[model samples]
Target: MSIVDGNPNVDTTVFYNASNENNLLYPDKFHQWQTRNNFKSYRQIGRFSDNEIAEHLPVDKDKTVVLIGGPDKMGSHWIKALKQMGIERSQIYYEKFSW
Candidate 1:
């Protein structure tokens, strides 16, 4: 998963990938970029904390935002924050999956 802060002046991209044990792994190069760019990254087990939710919210409050992901509780937290920020529920889109 990745999140961009949406700052044209400060380009930042955080990447987290789940490994075999459901642990997140970050590439060395990515880590280097994060350190150099002062970007924040995380390795989450299942759910994300409110701080993490706050970090992902766009810095540009005027810009429209979209959250896309498979059905999961993590998305709910993001939806809550967006709603609290006055974004319409219709603006959020969840990708569908068929079991």
Candidate 2:
């Protein structure tokens, strides 16, 4: 597994692996980012075939919405839709060479 700090100012961490495991694991100090940032409320929309990713998305609308996957064409499609929905690219983190 590899860990990455998505942004310099943010303490949140993202984990990825070739086995198709990708996720943002919040540090204890950044737990507030999960709550205060409304990460608990956003509904997670994922590809029908990607039940694992969909299951991790926010169940409510107040949480930070997450779109997970590699940079494959499918993931790119989701990224585009997310952008259309006003989600900043910075908010969408992916692992290096995840595709």
Candidate 3:
């Protein structure tokens, strides 16, 4: 997930189970992203970059992509960048979020 907050303590553990293999008494839930997912959380203090987006995407550009952006026309920026990167308008699905 992409969180633009500048808070250094914005940890992702809260979104997942804290219990690890050693803590057998409270094993992690199957749905925990930390335990079951493979992703890298980037702590960018400024604007997002194309390399950052491209690195995580599949080489096969044929697949459709989804973007969930925040308020203040946050979705607009990424949409334009994606288009410039050769992504088709029809291939993108976006949802602007306000929180």
In order, candidate lDDTs are 0.55, 0.44, 0.49
TM-scores of the models, in the given order? 0.46, 0.33, 0.52
How far off is residue 38 in model 2, in Å?
Answer: 11
Report RMSD (Å) for each prediction in the order shown: 5.1, 8.3, 11.7
Which residue pairs overlap in candidate 3's backbone?
none
Q: Measured by TM-score, how close is model 1 to the native structure?
A: 0.46
TM-score: model 2 vs. ground truth: 0.33
TM-score pick, better of 1 and 3? 3
Which tens-of-lDDT digit does each residue in 2-76 have in candidate 1? 344344245443424243433454456455556545555655456555566566666675554464564565567
Query: Candidate 3 on 1-99: residue-level lDDT in tens?
Result: 333123233322221111243422222232333343443343333455677776655566676455444554667877777787778888765676563
Which candidate number maximizes lDDT? 1
In model 1, which residue pairs have backbone atoms overlapping below 3 Å?
none
- The alpha-carbon lDDT assigned to residue 43 of candidate 3 equals 35
TM-score of decoy 3? 0.52
Candidate with top TM-score is 3
